[model samples]
Target: MSTVTNQAVGKVTRTRGSRAWRPYLYHIIVGLLSLLMIYPILWMAASSLKPNSEIFTQAYTLIPSKLEWNNYVSGWKGIGGISFATYYKNSFIIVIFATIGSVLSSALVAYGFARIKFFGSAFWFGCVMMTLMLPHDVTIIPQYIMFAKLQWLSSFKPLIVPFFFGVPFFIFLIMQFIRTIPHELDEAAKMDGCSKYGIFFRIILPLIVPALVTATIFSFYWRWEDFFNAVLYLNKAQMYPVSLALKMFLDGESISNWGGMFAMATLSLVPVILVFLIFQKYIVEGISTSGLKG
Candidate 1:
């Protein structure tokens, strides 16, 4: 019996040892991948701090030999033509309105699809799904012409208003998430004398916080990074977003301010990073819960 006990103890010890080593192996793999992902960002930050001369130098140093913080200062002032502050404001305004509009409109439309059964519901849903199959590039010219005819050119209206109508992808995502919730809850609410709007506002909205966060984060990121449309429709420099303003830093005629340009590029990425970090937990939870239900 003592020998058998010892044998069992030995097996348990081996299992414990394996478990400890497995985590270390995972850590090493993750560390390597993290370094791979972070290296470019580190290189960009280092280059931003270096003088124009040091950027192309043979030195493999991550730390700049001569740090010029003025690159950031000058970058903020922008090139000869524009100001980064104005661009920042423009981008912020567009992102705020677009994010709110997209989230609210998508949630409402999603609720309609998920909860209500009306005539041609499946057909309309199919149409919405088909929109996802069509590329935005394919519809850009028609959208641009429509906007131009409506005299929305050179304004933030084009960027902001479309979101209020609901984006197809976000609508689909939210609809899936809503469907994951049991219909019994809605029935119970209705039995308790709650109206459909009341059920939506009080119960459904609270439950789908994760989906809303995910949608908001996505919308904000897209609006912030939207340069193609900004360039296409916006003629006035004052109306350009940070995305377009960043391009002005590159002067192909003579010498581009590589340090300043990189500094601005790094700065440009901060809002996106912050927004992601803020809602990352909700985004993950929302997707996970939505998958389990549907």
Candidate 2:
């Protein structure tokens, strides 16, 4: 009996040792992968502090011999007359309004599809969903022609206006979220002498806050990074956003301000990082919960 007991104790000890090593192994693997993913960003930051010539010389190394703080100052001044602040202001103005327009319009449209029973409602909703599968590039030419006819080209109007109509993907996302919400709430609100608009404002609006935030985050990020539309619609350098201004740093792939570009590029990521950190919880929860319901 003593021999059996010793054998059992030995097996338990072995199992404990194996289990203890698993967590450390997992952590090491994850840490390595995390470093791999962020390595480019780290390199960019280090290079931003490097001298222009040293960027190529020390391309493989993340550390520079001497840190060049002036890269940030020069990058901020940018090329020619306008400054980086002008690009930042333009981006913020477009992003804020576009985010609001997309979230609000998508919510309203989604509510109509989810709650209101109107003629041809199903068909219209189907059309909206179909747009999700449609490629955006297909609409560019037609949209540009229409904007040109309206004399809306070479301005922010082209970028900001379509968001007011509702982004198809966001409309679908919000609609799915609204479907999960119990119709009983709407019914109860109606019984309490609440009109359709009142139900939307008081009940649905508050409940779908997470979904709306998800849409807002996505919309803001996309618009802030949008280069295609900005380049197509905006002709004047003064009206250019950070997306285009960054392009100006390169002169036909020959002479480039490598240090300054890296510096500005790092600065450009700040807003996106801050936003994601702030709303990350809601983003995860919203995307997960607002799906596969009624």
Candidate 3:
């Protein structure tokens, strides 16, 4: 009986010990994968500090033989006498206005779809949802012609104006989030003599802060990194955003300033990283809860 009891205790101990190492093993694997994913970004940062001649020569090395801070200074000086500061200013102007427009318009439209009932509402909602399946590439030509006809080409209007109508993806995301809120709250606000706009502004808007923040972050990222639209609509070098300005480093007719390009590329990532770190929590909470019921 004593021997049997000892054997059973040893078996339980072995089983518990085996399960404990699994978590550690899982963490190690995940850590390796994360490192692999971020290695390119880390390498680029290191390369920015390397001598221009050594960048491609020692491409595999993450450490520079000697730091070259001049790369950043040269990059900031920019092309055609336009400084990086101008590019940054242009980028901020487009991103801020477009992000605000996207978030506010999306929220208002989403509220109507989720809470208010009107004639042909379901049909209109279906049309909005169907747009998610449509690619922006399909409509680019038509949009370009329309903007051209209005003489809005080569201007910021083409970049920022469309966002005022709301983004299809964000509209759906906010609509789903709004649907999760209890209707009783809206009814109660109405009983207190709250107007429709008051219910939206005072009650619904405040409750959906997480979703709004999520939309804002996404809109900021999209607008900040918009290269295709910038290149398509912007003709003047002085009017270029950072995304388009970066391309000026490449001189097809002469040697390209790759080191300067890499340096500015590293700097451009700062705002994006800061935004993500600041609002990451809301992104997770908003996405997870937005789908809870609707």
Worst ten in a row by lDDT for model 3: 285-294
lDDT of 2 by residue, 248-292 (tens): 888885788888989999999999999999999989878887777
The estimated TM-scores of all candidates read 0.90, 0.95, 0.97
Clashing pairs in 2: none
Candidate number achieving the greatest lDDT relative to the actual structure? 3
Error of 1 at 96 (Å): 0.7
lDDT of 1 by residue, 1-294 (tens): 999999999999999999989989999999999999999888888888999888879347789987889999988888666778888999999999999999999999999999988999999999988999898899999999999999999899998998899999889889989998889999999999999899999899999999899888888888989989899988988888999987887777988888888898899899989887877898888777777755
The local distance difference test score of model 1 is 0.89
User: Per-residue lDDT for 190-274 in model 3, tens only?
Assistant: 9999988999999999999999999999999999999999999899988899999999999999988888999999999999999
Q: How should the candidates be ordered by TM-score, best one leading?
A: 3, 2, 1
Regions of model 2 farther than 4 Å from truth? 292-294
Best by TM-score: 3
Q: Per-prediction RMSD in angstroms?
A: 2.6, 1.6, 1.1
Model 1 — TM-score against the truth?
A: 0.90
